[model samples]
Target: MMKMWRVGLDEAGRGPCLGPLVVGLCAVPINDVALLVEAGVKDSKDLSIKKRRELVDWYKQQMDSREWKYVVNICSPQRIDAALSKDGLNILEVDLFAECLNSLSQQLSENVSILADACDVNPQRFTDRIIARIRNWPWQQSEMDSIHKADSIDPVVGMSSIFAKVTRDEMIEEISQQVGFSVGSGYPSDPNTQKILGRLVTSPLPHSELRWSWATIKNKWMEKYETPPPIRNESINVQKTLF
Candidate 1:
């Protein structure tokens, strides 16, 4: 029998007002799908920080053994801003997810099954958009679905989330190191993030890692600098929803 591949895709830092949007892809042989669940893989959001860190390490070891394969694409704040300025978040995600799929497809054989955590409110629409962007389809008898909360529903997507979450956290730490202070989780509700924003906005130039297009940052910039923060010209209409 031909080996079957099961793939999952998810993203981290989508809601954060800072940091890059990191998309993760994880794949394993269909029969080995149980291995992920047996190894306690679940949505990163449901895992504790220590647990998530531990799983990330374990996953790296497994990938090294060729037990499975994975890929990650980190979309920087600047690129994200540019995307938002044009087509919007949905298009950005579709493009990025397709990019990751293309990379993964290069490594796999036929009969691949892919499940993606939906970036759009309409799951089928999101799936269709991604499929439309993929350069290779039906080339390998592949099937794909994008659904809301796939990370929680599918172990593979949960594993993908673990990768994305850990990677984004490390990136945030690097940004903190560069800034010489902690930027917190980069979420708007994070007090440390809010505090850092206050300090960062006073600077004559915007922070490179900060998402200036975010309303949070724009408001802060306007409040402190007494002028609208420079953002891309949004010439195209898109879904008004931010997340």
Candidate 2:
């Protein structure tokens, strides 16, 4: 018989300074997977936040029917740094994927195929890294692989992306409330995120929750301690989002 199953895998909070990295993999039969996609499913980025949310509920309904199941592996920032330092990010990511898929294998047995959003768009040595990483993990399925642009290509990945993004957005909103500002997406390029960092950098605050290794963070820290030459905008400008 032709191979007849599908899986969608994705990660959330990859760039966040706070919270865990949630890696999720969901599987559906190829037939139903296509049915779900044919119902106007697409990548998370292609839909509005509200639509993505609606899809999450619908996808959850599909899952609740026992037609599929998902696993969300949550790992803290410290854990990610430790693993990345041990063998670099790509390998560590594959290691995480291996762990998750290995668990999924016991349920699906040896017949299913696994597809993942390849961490690097153009992988060089990652293939070897993935091959080696899965060997020790429990997902002993003989055929799991990573492909570039998996999200754009795989309907499974599109669904998985919805779960990942929704989960991350909820966490971001919670964190914003806790921190008392619209810190934005927690990415370096986000101006609101930068503004929040500026406040923390200027105040006598400790680097308690921040990702200290970000280039922007490192540069700001150096400027604070070393007393670098004053720039045009030395003062912190934290844009308060009035609720």
Candidate 3:
């Protein structure tokens, strides 16, 4: 009997003011989807850190047995800034999603049904764009489905989300150790991140991982360097797209 596969892709750190954006892909046999469900797999956000770590360890074991396949694409802060300056976040995500999918497709020989947590407002459009980007796509009877909040609804996508979240979290921890200070979650809303953001234009860290194009960084640069700041009535376009 031939095998059929389900490929799920998701991302983490898209909205952070610091750190890299990570996209993850997980491919499992269609008949084995229930195995993941029975093993308590769900959205990463709903699982505690310890739970996520436990599940990741289990996933590694499964991979060792060739029961599944996975991969991740890390988009550095510099790469993200360049994307924003060129195409934009949506295009960047499309590329990253395709990159991850292609990595897994190279190893698998069966038809795949791709499920992605949509990053674009129009889920169908997102689905179409991804299909168009893939190389030698539609292998056998392959197909793709992109839906909003797929992580919460589809166990496969949820697994992918967990992989992405855990990878990004580890990277953030490494960055903290390197800087000798905790940067928090690297989101602007994070108090620790906000407190450290003021130093971007002043005592800039030797680490070049900071997203220089973010509005948070731009505002800090202007606040520290601009003289006689414009009045509130003046028009200012410091805000950058957050994807």
* Per-model CA lDDT versus the true structure: 0.84, 0.64, 0.80
Ranking by TM-score: 1, 3, 2
Clashing pairs in 1: none
lDDT: which is higher, 2 or 3?
Answer: 3
TM-score of each: 0.92, 0.79, 0.89
| Candidate 3 overall lDDT versus native | 0.80
Task: Flag regions of model 3 displaced more than 4 Å.
Answer: 203-207, 227-243
Report RMSD for candidate 1: 4.9
If ranked by lDDT, best first, what sequence of candidates would result? 1, 3, 2
Off by over 4 Å in 2: 1-3, 16-20, 121-128, 135-142, 201-208, 227-243
Model 2 — which ten-residue stretch has the worst lDDT?
Answer: 234-243
Give a tens-digit lDDT track for model 1, residues 88-193. Answer: 8889989889888878766674688999999998999999988887775765677999889999999999999998898899899999999899999999999989
lDDT per residue for candidate 2 within 42-141, as digits (tens), equals 7777889999888878777776565576665655545655554456556657766666665665566444666788786655454456556654433334
